[model samples]
Target: MEIVKGSGFIPGDLLSKINSPSDLKKLNEDQLEQISSELRQYIIDLVSVKGGHFGASLGVVELTVALHYIFNTPYDQLVWDVGHQAYGHKILTGRRDNFHTNRVYKGLSGFPKRSESEYDTFGVGHSSTSISAALGMAVASKYKNLKDKQHIAVIGDGAMTAGLAFEGLNHAGVENANLLVVLNDNCMSIDPNVGALKEYLTDITTSHTYNKAKDKVWELLGKISKFGPNAQEIASKIENAVKTSLLKQSNLFESLKFRYFGPVDGHDVVRLTKVLADLKDIPGPKILHILTKKGKGYKFSEEGNETVWHSPGLFNKDTGEIIKVIPKTPQPPKYQDVFGHTIVELAEKNLNIVGITPAMPSGCSLNIMMKAMPDRAFDVGIAEQHAVTFSGGLASQGLVPFCNIYSSFMQRAYDQVIHDVALQNLKVIFCLDRGGLAGADGPTHHGAYDIAYFRCIPKMIVSAPMNEEELRNLMYTAQLDEVKTAFSIRYPRGQGVMVDWKTPFKKIEIGKGRKIKDGKELAILSLGHPGNLVTEAIERLKEQGINAAHYDMRFAKPIDEALLHEVFTSYTKIITVEDGCIIGGMGSAVLEFMADKNYSARVVRLGIPDNFIEHGEQVELYEECGFSPKKIAETAIEILKENKQTILKQGGTSLHDKQA
Candidate 1:
């Protein structure tokens, strides 16, 4: 690393001079190996302190360096599938200095943002998008008569399992476009890749039969010079004969008309650069399969659990020890963990219950049940739509399918939810994790829309838990025979409220809300974990001599109309808070209820605003969205201070957009 008259350390020698791909172009191909090392080290340096994605970028150091070195980025179009491994790409493309701010509030985003850099062709957080996106750019390039332009989609093998990726590949093969799909086969996503595709890829990547055939063909090509002009044709024929026999069914990419290239070493920067340069000259759609380890360089990440190292918050780079802050007291368990344990408990009692997740067993803690009862759990790889539909299939039988999906990812499977599950009126327990603002991942990952989206769906019971106990109760209730049809239980990413959350299983009556406080002033209705915020806000309001009523409105769909009626009759002033969008959310349901009953109340809805919320801490994002305890209290105080008649005239007549 080099100081280079800067405040902090920057990239070393070859890397520091190279501001962009143009600068990288100035260096000889031989120097790229050194640049790759420096880039890898820099990523390690920054991510260890700044706390962002770790192993993925380390794994793709060579690929990122080689791609930038070979292609005309910001022009040729290089799109990373998920941007988990694009840290090196960002650093090389004019973000080296500012890389420290990665995933920080108002700093560079954790994932690729088109607005952040011209080089980042697509704004990506989700996987399996690069192939389709790059194919679009390639088709456009062909239309524009830009012959020299190249469009490359660097996708993980884990992402390859998605129907979208296959759809893109199927389309790309038919299109006459200068496109290259670099399959970075690490045999892992966040967790190890699953399904038949992983097995097929494994066979291709590590089969003795394929390896022997490959060596024999290479040897035959080397000795082909002994023959004459027909040697090239003869060699090609021999290679084709061997490939046809061995990869009869396994040659999936080739069957789609893509000129499939080797399962090459992705870490070999020199070979990679050479192959990429050569492919750019050869037109049409093709795929280059390169095998890479998830955590390629760093010792700890390379040896440790790839999933844990995928986004290991912080670490000691020298010692290889992951940083940890040991709290004095036992903290509350993560909501996912609670769900993991609770599901196992339920599945043990009910033989018909099964768990399902799309490429996120560990992330959502489904891995716990997967380990406990292997037959009753599945990890569908990076295919949210498939997971939902597959769960629906399970529901078609007598089995109760607990389909766990992240709230943000569930958006991808909206069609499946509506058509496959909801429309069929199947008993699919949709356990939507990361239910609210997923902090630090920004708009792409925030679980702000599930409440609105799920609530709108017919026969879908949209619900969120205030704490772990509620999560357990809700999970227990959904599995029961009483809760028919598609039921969704949304919960946030972090820890729940209660430390002793492993309470006895209890059943919660659907649509019935619980009152936390009784007050004279406005009533505060909250949905999900954000109800805790209302509790704090109500306490704050009392300090200011204003008493506020609070209700934990658990279910958004069959919303507690009776409970809402009780509150409406008692208090003319109301504040509805939720960790979801103000539009079409629980608050909206309250407004709808108010209008339906022909009641007048000053309804101030506090939640995520109309705009996209950026990356930050959970607290910071809560404050930004104006639903933090402080903001909630302030909004209530303002509402309480105003004259009853004037406030009623302004807001009581209809909904108040306090968020707007």
Candidate 2:
């Protein structure tokens, strides 16, 4: 392993000694403190160049060091919620050498994967699973009669706001499992957390009356415990009674039957280690509330918007200045920006239009709408299930709620989408941003199944835009007063093809497709952003004397039967391509349509396969799945040649002549 040594790189001589959690156990409290500083600096220097999740990892450096130091990891389970804060945990657990390759293709995963390491007991990418996983581990240990083993779950306050966290808490409280849930309260999760829970936690952490009362009660109980079991029982009853009556307003965790501990300083390695060591001796489900600032120890990150600095692209470590590589040519706006800007414009004209995102205003570009119309826009915290149902409620009252959620996150609220919106036939327009491979975020973040999931449901209109203009038009059409069905518009992560995409809002016909090029013998049909690849492939095929017709079939659910009949009647061969999984995707839809209509044109399907794709650049992933322009062109060429051979073998006229 190479030790990065330079002006910016902090002296990590102490850090270099740490190969595993057992290695950390060898170090004293003072040395552990040094390791914490080194770990934070190492992450700062590493992420400065490589660019991964910044704020969460930086905030949890001390906690990571302390947990491993106190607990026997690989035996004692430590499940990290969301896995953004697990970088330090990964580094300390024998991944330090390969840490630089984080989030890269075929490199170490950015999040925890059980297959990656034995230390990673549970794979995690989404938030609020840690408590449940930890409780399960604790229960499993008990089943095996292994009382010596411990289970700890470190979760952020932002993730704790989710309903899943509460469900886990409710179950764990009832189970009375030997589990410790460390709440890393940084008052943020991408953006500052909102709602009643945030307010409640803020009050508990800040209230002098609550703190003083808790201290006095504990002090009285400790003194009374010295009088033996009889007096101790009386003391305990009195304490519980007092707490249940007076502390009910603040201590919600205790109400759930878990022993709640302090708002301790999360950055103090020595104090955190001591607290963790003490907590190990105690029994049952517990929650240690530690207060830490997001983007701690870095001056610029501390001063700037921590939200932007959370995953700000590569930057200079010493100066904290973001390294912006200027593009050689003018580039098109991102699909997210198109949605962000267009919603504000549409909302201005239509007062009924409102935007809601599940704790992703900045991510989905709904921050633009939030800034323009504060009353109309809502950041509903990390609650996908609630966000969907809340939108349903708004839609019920005759409001046009544009529920903007990431494609992957939408899976959490599928029940609500079916029950609240689809069943009621409410006009809730779902703008699924990141509707394809989510690039570096990998399989957990990819929006590969929305088309299949939504298309299977009744009264749900599923569509994907080929470009920025189409997305804008789709938004316009969905928001129209006449449209009553539940509509979903999925668009990809990065920039769109059109530079001048701020075209006037024109309504797109539902279940309609337009041909991009004229050709013979083969017709290449595509859905969503993959149509851009089809367009490029068709143009390239033209140079090879292989003219193939291209169509952007916008709607996946409502198949354009009229266009399909025309293509099947005209062409001898047909190809379907999409950016989602092949099994139940656009290609599958086409195959199902063909079988029902009995139009057999020798169909070929191309898309992501049945298996999960790992982290990589979007282009590389698309190419791997055979959805890239070059790959699509190659497939088209192969199909065209085979069709020609079939025609020749049949003693028919030339392929072009037959088609003509």
lDDT of each: 0.87, 0.88
lDDT of 2 by residue, 1-660 (tens): 454433234338878878899888998877877898889888998899989999989999989999999899989999999898999999899888788888999889999999999999998999988998899999988888888899999999889878999999999998867899999999999999988888888887787766667655545544553455466366456547656654565468887988776667798888788778766766688888899988998898999999988899899988989998889988899999999999999999999999999999999999999999999999999999999999999999999999999999999999999999999999999999999899998998999899899989998999999999999999999999989989999999998998889999999999998887767758999998899999888888888887789888999979898988888778768899998888888888888888898886788899888899999999999999898999999998887778778877997775458445
**Which ranges of candidate 2 are over 4 A from the true structure?**
1-11, 211-249, 645-655
Measured on C-alpha atoms, candidate 2 has an lDDT of 0.88
| TM-score to true structure, per model | 0.94, 0.95
Q: Tens digits of per-residue lDDT for model 1 on 379-488?
A: 98999999999999999988999999999999999999999989989999999999889999989999999999988998789889999999999999999987778899
lDDT of 2 at 327: 92
Of the candidates shown, which would achieve the greatest TM-score relative to the real structure? 2
TM-score of 1: 0.94
